[model samples]
Target: MTPRFAITDAEIATVVAEFYAVARTHPGLGPVFAAHVTDWPAHEAKITRFWKNAIQFDRSYDGNPLQVHRDATDVRAGMFDVWLGLFDSVLRRQLPPETAAAWSTLAHRIGRGLRFGLTPQNGGPPDLRGPAR
Candidate 1:
């Protein structure tokens, strides 16, 4: 899909609000977010800022996303997929087609990075690891 100029903060806020509403209730994600995020409003604003930085290169956000997810002991591998799924659904519902696709692509990539960073690396399975001991 073609890029539509740059997404605005208002659009960012809308996406954050609508997406988190779904996330805050998603079966795989609800408990994780509930456990980590106590203040919804503040969390929404932080997410908006994060997206603003991502979509607009505004550099208004300063939080460490990797560390934040790493710190969330409740974060799990499949949860990122759930997060991305909900984000894509909400963005598609609320925004233009190109805008939704672009943001969803970004979210999916970020989700992959988070999933990788968050999942524990206990060496690999026997098959994936070097010859068995």
Candidate 2:
């Protein structure tokens, strides 16, 4: 089933552009991200594909985001928080309330999963499960 509130590619691009603009304004992340994304056209295309897969569930993206993030060692912890905050702000400004909520939830889950590896036992099993009942 299609979502009632769907965001288009143009919308995603707008959000991403705004996000990069915000990053550029911030001293902590601006220099690092700008240096890494020296090739603006290529970086934009990659990010566009990434977000397309994220919001639209496109199957073409087979990249490992965890590995990518790990490779970007220059991305400090605080930068992640700032990035999320900027994303949330953009979603709130651009998307419908329901869409924004859903996207925020998804972003949070992805962030958590990336920061802390997901467990195969489903969150390490419930404490009250009593040793696999």
Candidate 3:
């Protein structure tokens, strides 16, 4: 059988819905995220566009994710972990095991990279990684 490279819009919608539900239930990050994403419809539209472009190369998205997340400032290190966990949960619930694993791996790497880039180097908040002795 040929490998299936396509994911349906319904699958994407399910994942997104599950993701938001998890985010809303997350301990520390939930309230902050809910407050920030007040415009659910707009946020959903943007996110849908993002995923569509990501998986299908349909260049309909036009937002700077790095800049937006950087400006959010509330997306701390632990929050990244929570976000990834939710993403993994949604993928697992909606897709085949192998597909979920692959997607989760990619999402984890991207999330980690984004978090690392967003973290600022300063004496303000103690460095995430301690200095060498």
Candidate 4:
């Protein structure tokens, strides 16, 4: 079932667009995302789909976020904090208070999972667990 956040696809898109627009220029996040995402618009659209599928369960996105994050060797554990901070700011700016809070909660949850998956366990490299395939 979908979430009860009362967020719309357009608001999600706005949050994604605004977040990336600022994040792409951020000193910490800019280089990493720039290295991987060549097409900004397409990347934003894909991310929009990802969020839609995440919050609304629309099934419009079909990629493994964990696998994708694992593939980005430059993605450090601390980056999640920065990303989430930027995302929260965008969400608050673009959405209503209740919607922003609910979406932020979900984003933080997903960010925690991603950070755990990317972090090294027992001093070894992070496990890939095969792949999204």
State which candidate has the highest TM-score: 4
lDDT of 1 by residue, 1-133 (tens): 3222467778889989998888877777788889999999999989888888766767789898878887887777777766777788888888899888878877776777677776678332222111233
Best by lDDT: 4
Q: Candidate 2 regions off by >4 Å?
A: 1-5, 117-133
- Provide TM-scores for the models: 0.84, 0.75, 0.80, 0.88
Between candidates 2 and 4, the TM-score winner = 4
TM-score, model 2 to reference:
0.75
lDDT of 4 at 109: 78
lDDT tens digits by residue: candidate 2, 59-114: 55667766666677775544566778877998899778887887787676566655
Q: Global CA lDDT of candidate 2, please?
A: 0.68
Predicted candidate 4, C-alpha RMSD: 5.2
Model 3 CA deviation exceeding 4 Å by range: 1-4, 122-133
The candidate 4 region of ten consecutive residues with least summed lDDT is 124-133
lDDT of 4 by residue, 1-133 (tens): 7354577778888898899999989999999999999999999999999989888778899999988988899898779999999999988888888888988888887887788877777343344322342
